[model samples]
Target: MIRIAQLSCGAEYSGIQRELERAAEIVGAKMISPEVSLEDVMDVEKRFGVSVPSGDLNLIMARATRLVENPDLADAVFVATCFRCAEGAIIRGEVRRYIHEHSRLPVLSYSFTERTTAETLLTRMEALVTTARMRGLLARERQTGLTAGIDSGSTTTKAVIMRDNQIIGRGWVPTTEVIKSAEEAFQQALQESGVKREEIQGIGVTGYGRFLVGKHFDAKLIQEEITVNSKGAVFLANAQKGPATVIDIGGMDNKAISVQDGVPGSFTMGGICAGASGRFLELTARRLGVNITDLGKLALRGSYKSVPMNSYCIVFGTQSLVNSLSKGARPEDVAMAACHSVAEQVFEQQLQEVEVKQPVIMVGGTSLIEGLPKAMEDLLGIEIIVPNHAQYIGAVGAALLVSGMLEV
Candidate 1:
């Protein structure tokens, strides 16, 4: 169904706008405009403090089937593209609330550090549907009870409730202080699942911030991300697949791993770089006048020469992009350049200690960017395979792990 997309990445707003053209290509997809609904326009005043323009909000609020039947013509829209530049996940939290209150369609939100692609973007959307379907089966009947897993990623918090390895409910929220976000999203999934707190047999937490909340969980499993990630990946990847490298771009950090036998064996981290994580891509997308979700598809054009961006520092990059534009650099080129630098840096970091595994797994929000994986895979000379549930990996693993565990 054609729907409105409300994108609020970080600072690089101009970069995003120029990158999200693919979103406009969805068969029935309609880009938001003033003609559809009021609340979705860029800086469209909140008339009477209730609704504004652009049908993005209404579309989100409306059921998908109904949207298909009585499709809102004013489907597409562009937000400020730069609401809270450095607010981190706080802005995401607020954005989610805004999309929830305004639109009737299921909001398709994606964040980036460098750039993502269409395949990666669809993988996330697929994860949501798969999780929802898995949730349906648990409702039929069960005896072992249900469990919830909380993946406290550096940028976002995702929770899943499952019974017998099947997802019963899921929740995705930005990470605002690890423990707090975990608690909040945990409660949300429980409420959404309509399952009582006591009914939850166990809880698992993963990612960089997992430790902070591990103490609070029903039973915290402080294992490597590769372990938890593979647990989730194997479920989504084709059975014919073999050893692979997984590159997970979180909001605050980046992880690279080698997985074989459906388990993580070796891995590395690039520390935390606000200038080059999934959120940065989002900010850049917004700056370029495109949606982050549309970044990868737009970048696929790859014809123009890239505009040079000196530093990966967010603020510096923002200023540099403006100066580059003034210097007459093509927007497409500039966006791809930013993605290139990030890919180069990631490859350098991942290849520092160990050789990168072939058939790589590109997970997290950054993977969804259109051309990012292509660029990175080329640089690393390896195949990159992004799984369907990449974003929900930590949450899904934690949930499945907790489902059969005895109380600890």
Candidate 2:
């Protein structure tokens, strides 16, 4: 079992520590809290250059420093704090960064509310386990034989057929019935690739409906999108050999992942509201009387600064759009503002949790939006690469990883 060290404060008092352990147990991993001495706790303030009144917080710092000194104590690190505690939040980031920089172990950081449940942490734990146990598979540089990957996402379903490191076919469609949509996408890919179904050696499924679709298709791999999407993003961008960051702004959520050598070392996903998601942009395009595709081009023609927008809630974001148009703001400017609003929230909520490394690759359907990437570039002050077929990221990742199963 992968041993995941927990460096957290307030989880026990907040009554959510059991949820964390349950999440790790469900993913077939062990959650271990490193032993720290009273002496070690006392020296933490002097050694780490931080002072805290809370003994629990001090112990957290001591545990983090101990992990750095003894890297093999855990396969990965999970740093967390109560969402309501300001000091714990700050120290959480410091601990995460400290462990990440000092050791090669994968690190995941989260701020949990009292309501946080095992289901909420399941994906994170699964990603940690996958990162620790499947490094060789994730670091595999090439695809072999025939494989197909299907992404049953919240907004759309995508399918890809790959043969020996090259994509031969692709399919995309709006999500309706989960199994029906997945099958439709797979059939389209199968027909496009001109390959018989029986000849394909492996199949992979990912996204929100992965469990349902994976069971229906007998998928060789049923994985979460965090690891799968990062792999696909780097693969499509051809940045698998070095450090890279992937930002996927999806319909329901957003993910910011920091990767090294094609494997995800750290990642953050989800947001406070839909204001930071592609769905918000879809609403913006509807109000502007333009197709979603045209919103990007329209945004490029105007400046976001000309319009006042909210990035906190989707309802308020749409209200801002209505009020802007009422005030005679150009549809073009409104378009840019909407894109920037989503980008801004993503930058604040998700990007801040993980260290951003370059070359940054933006994937998912939202990446096709010219203004979204442009807005991210403006916020990040770096060029964002939207690779060919960026929209099929999950499907591509599924296809790529399942190819490894063919060798066995």
TM-score of each candidate structure, all chains considered together: 0.57, 0.98
Cα lDDT of model 1 by residue, 201-230, tens digit: 777677766767887774644433545665
Which 10 successive residues of model 1 have the least lDDT summed?
134-143
Give the whole-model CA lDDT for all candidates, comma-separated: 0.56, 0.92
| Alpha carbon deviation, residue 135, candidate 2 (Å) | 1.0
List CA RMSD, all candidates.
20.1, 1.1
Model 1 CA deviation exceeding 4 Å by range: 1-145, 191-194, 220-226, 238-242, 271-273, 302-304, 310-316
Evaluated with lDDT, which candidate comes out highest? Answer: 2
Instruction: Give the winner by TM-score.
Output: 2
